[model samples]
Target: MIRCRQFYLGYPNSATVSHLLTWSHWIELLKIDDVLERSFYEQQTLLERWSVRELIQQKESALFLRLAASKDKAGVLQLATQGQQIEQPADLLRKPYIFEFLKIPEPYQIAETQLETLLCDHLQPFLLELGKGFTFVGRQYRITLNNRHYKVDLVFYHRILRCFVLIDLKINEVQHQDIGQVNMYFGYFAQEENIEGDNPPIGIILSRNKDELLIEYATYQMNSQLFVQKYQLYLPNQEDLRRELELTLREGTENASQSAKTLLDENDDT
Candidate 1:
């Protein structure tokens, strides 16, 4: 009884969403200690309509850490307050997307085709993992150009972005050629596949490994919207991810202070 009162005291907004959340949901949320993280999960649960089990899964996967690790301090605060507003193409990205629902054991030696098949078989969970606004178009979607045929591993339409998202899966590390290939698909999609009212297509390369230096060199000054991210067959190490998020936050804080100092110096000079 005392704990319940303390929980309510900590979370004043709980009264507003009382109609939506059950005791089970509150129980799952109570496990969280960070106020910002608790608010994030609470808001996302309402937005995504996640069940108790799904909420548990997300918390275990360290969804907050995964999303916050890539953002600046303001972005992290927005996540806590607004719960993932997808206004830009970059907002759709999540680093090292998790696919533990596939139930595939690690040391992933499976073929790319097999991986695609597994994701398709577990389509519902995959879509949820992919984040919001993704509606699957087709698997092994074919693209024809000049009497030649190319198969895209997976295709999804983003309702919010109003664009087609093409995915290419790689069991091994991503290469320069892979980026060029996805970029070509993006061009083809922009010209041939997209109809009126459609935004330019974006491409994603999902691989077991990603060489950041290779991607940086390969995608330098590229015009198209293309992203390369790694996929984990198993759940991530939450402690490691938390440490990474903490480091990113500390760096962002330092950078923000440095920028403020620079601005003050400029003002003084003027």
Candidate 2:
């Protein structure tokens, strides 16, 4: 009662007051312990106009942590107020795009056809994994150039980003050739399908495992917007995600510290 009265007096705008007094809204905010994080979610709820279900999904998916963990260094203010802003190509990508919804056995070495079939079979869950604002275009979409035919595994139009995204499925570890092929796919889209209003197409190679060493060596000089992500057949354990999130946060802090020291050293040298 005291808190509510204080809240009423502390900020007197009716819109803010209504939001503060909403029991469900307060309940959602109470779910998080960190004050900054709670405030971020509150801002997201207001800006995104998320329903109760959407709020739960955001929490369960660890959306804030996942976005924060990216090398892009999006701060709390960005997460709170921006509401998943796509400032650049990298912002649209996740490190390990989760695909536990496919329901395939973890040990099963499934063929590419079967995997694609399963994705199309459960398209709704696939879109959720794909991220917000994706509309399915087709599976195995065909595009012909120079008297030859090429097939894209899965095609989607990201409504928010306003671009065509082409995904190729690989049932094995990602290789340099996978990047090459996806680049070609994007090239085809850029030439033929991408019209004036559309952004250059984005390509993703979804593989059973990501070969970090190979990816680093091959993609170091590559400028194309191609990404390779590993997919798991099972949903990751919630505890495991929490641990990973903590580690990522620590790593991000250390990286930022290192960057600041390097800048200071450079200034001293000059």
Candidate 3:
């Protein structure tokens, strides 16, 4: 029988065992520590796939606090992880966004009949409002479908979205039929114009009045892509805008505090 010494009892690599065991306990403790704590380092390292240096930059920039400020936490997470992989990147939330199409120099008072002409005159700005990667295909595009003629107010092709955006300008209240009509337009565009990789065309109706309930029901049933936004000829009250900003700020702060507390609790339980 071979006599084994205490140091060489288990394995041939005695020095290797000593080296690994010396630090192994601390490493295991760290793994348990990470499991027991919701460290920002661990969360960010997993989520953002950040390098040590990038993690430092994110901390310096207060990225987590900024992310916590979002009204939609899921959307913020998606943005952080995927970086805005939207098929149709609409500016649905960008209030007071610049209306480049409406910019006209003073002393050049143009008639309402010349609205389309004026828009064409400053087509660049109009295209910008329509969103990036948009090209002016045509205005007053006439489509003959099902033995009926339909005239689209404005037609644009969005390169990034890889889809077409059909816009209908309305100076009055948006009716249920109006929504149906735009949805029909979307269907037509999807069937007739959309390429293989392109997303379904998006239809937008910019009207003076939009009925929330009506819009809700209209969009609920239809699989066709569409959005409706109310437009104002004049800017809103500055005081009202300021009050809204203040309220949003307060709400965001409160929500952030609550989220942090919840995270801390989960960590404690762990």
Cα RMSD for candidates in order: 2.2, 4.6, 16.3
| Residue pairs of candidate 1 with colliding backbone atoms | none
lDDT, model 1, position 124: 87
TM-score of 2: 0.75
Which candidate achieves the best TM-score against the true structure? 1
TM-scores, all candidates, are 0.91, 0.75, 0.59
The backbone clash count of each candidate, in order, is 0, 0, 0
lDDT of all the models against the reference? 0.87, 0.72, 0.57
Model 2, runs deviating above 4 Å: 1-26, 40-50, 72-77, 105-109, 237-270
Give lDDT tens digits, candidate 2, residues 1-270.
755564455446756444433667667766676654666677766655666766776676666655555533345446655556665666677656666656567477778999899899989667765666789999999988789988899999987788898999988888887788788887788888888899988888888688789898888877567888776665445566556556765777899899999999999999
For model 3 the TM-score comes to 0.59
**What's the lDDT of the predicted structure labeled candidate 1?**
0.87
Top of the candidates by lDDT: 1
Question: What lDDT does candidate 3 reach at residue 264?
Answer: 100
**lDDT, model 2, position 42:** 75
> In candidate 3, what are the lDDT values of residues 70-96, reduced to their tens digit?
335445444444432334445322243
Clashing residue pairs, candidate 3? none
